[model samples]
Target: MIYAFLNQKGGVGKTTLSIHTAAELSGRGRRVLLIDADPQGSSLAWSNYREKANFTVVGMPKATIHKEIDLLAQDYDDVVIDGPPRVTELARSIILSADIVVIPVQPSPMDVWAAAETVDLVREAQVYKPEIKCCLVINRKITNTAIGRDVRDALAELEVPVLKNDIGQRVAFAESAASGSTVLNQKLSKAAREIIKFVNELRRLK
Candidate 1:
């Protein structure tokens, strides 16, 4: 299975979510390959900082990745693509190359509005590959806030399903990233639990 984490707007936590999801899958003993499809190369940088990782991370920041992913994905059980931000053509290629496109939206009026373009691209890609599945996962959510609670309804207007399991605004995610590690490496902490629940719900999508 191939999963692409994408959002046209930056700072939506696409890279964080993609890397943690890849690490979680690897922790489960599955062969995982994380493709840094963003020209920013955030995922590749994370891999470089890490001393050791169970999974492999590679760079493919190109609009033509859809043409090359298959050969590179052959030996892996799962491939996770950390997509580029503010690049429509690259996003389209990532969407076409993925079996599932997971769009991470931050809870806010602007974030909700910004998602329309990404949703449109997903819909367009669906026209070409109807089997492709796409959904929104509310990230960096501030718990107990009205916006966080109402984001699902806001995203409803875009015609994309938002996942029930949402990741909250937590410092653990940043700390882990800075150290080239994942929350899962911290054991069953709050952050790790959130990611676990999120990924479990994701696995049920198909």
Candidate 2:
């Protein structure tokens, strides 16, 4: 399976989610590969920083990713693409190649509004790849905050379904990412548990 983490807006935590999700799957003994489709090479940089990565991480910033991904997918149990933050040909190619697209939306009105463009691209891709699943996961959420609740409610008005498992604004995420480690490497952290739950939910999707 191939999963693409995408959102047109930056600072929405797409790279963080992609790296963590790939790490989680790889830690579970799945043969996972992470493709850094973003021109910024965030995922590639993270992988380079890691002394040892359980999964393969590559930088493929070309618009022809849709054509290149299939050959690469044959060797891995799962492939996760960290998409670029613009509605460009590269983003479309990533969406077209994905089996599932996870859009990370921050808990704010601006973020929600920006996500609509991504949702639109997903819908357009679905016209061809009807089996391609798309969902929104609220990233960097603040627990017990009214803005969080409001954001969740507002997402309901969007065309895509929002995942029940949302990631809170935890320091662990930043610390782990900076050190080229994942939340799963931490001993009993809430961030780790949240990521595990979200990955499980994604696996359950047909």
Candidate 3:
């Protein structure tokens, strides 16, 4: 299965989630392959932080994606891609190649607009692959805030099925990214459990 973490806007924790998702699946006994389609290379650098890692994340340019996929095809059970900003052809390719596309958005108007464009991009890709599964995930949410409720309502009213699990803002997530460890490695954080549950549901969908 292939999953892409995407958002047009920056700082929505797309790469962070992508790395963690790859780690969680790898820990769960899946041979996970991660492709950092973004030129920023956050995922790739994070993957390199660990002296040894069970999963791998590679940085690949947009033009040679198909070739890279061919090389890694037989070596892994699942592929998770971290895509760049939306105004690029690379993100489209990532979406097209995914079995499931996960869009992570902040509970704010600007992020919502970014996610809207991403949703349309995914929809347009249906011409090439009509069976793709796409879903929205509200990330970096603040509980008891009106913004969180608004994001949930807006997505639901638009018929977008938001994930039942939400990613709360936590320092463990940041530390995990810097050290190439997932929240699953954080041991006792609530956010870690939410990330695990959310990714498990994503696995079930596949």
TM-score of each: 0.98, 0.98, 0.93
The 10-residue segment of model 1 with minimum total lDDT is 45-54
User: Which lDDT tens digits does candidate 3 get at residues 99-190?
Assistant: 89899988988888788888888888877789888988989898889999998878775455689888887788887667666778765679
Task: Report RMSD (Å) for each prediction in the order shown.
Answer: 0.8, 0.9, 1.6
RMSD of 2: 0.9
Expressed as tens digits, the lDDT of each residue in 110-164 for candidate 1 is 8998888899999999998999999999999998999888888989888888899
1 or 3, greater by TM-score: 1
Model 3: clashing residue pairs? Answer: none
Query: Is 1 or 3 the stronger prediction by lDDT?
Result: 1
**lDDT (CA) per prediction:** 0.92, 0.91, 0.81
> In model 1, how large is the Cα lDDT of residue 69?
86
Error of 2 at 111 (Å): 0.6
Q: What's the distance in Å from true for residue 155, model 2?
A: 0.5
Q: In candidate 1, how many Å is residue 71 off? A: 0.6
**Better model by lDDT, 1 or 2?**
1
Q: What clash count goes with each model?
A: 0, 0, 0
C-alpha-based local distance difference test score of model 2? 0.91
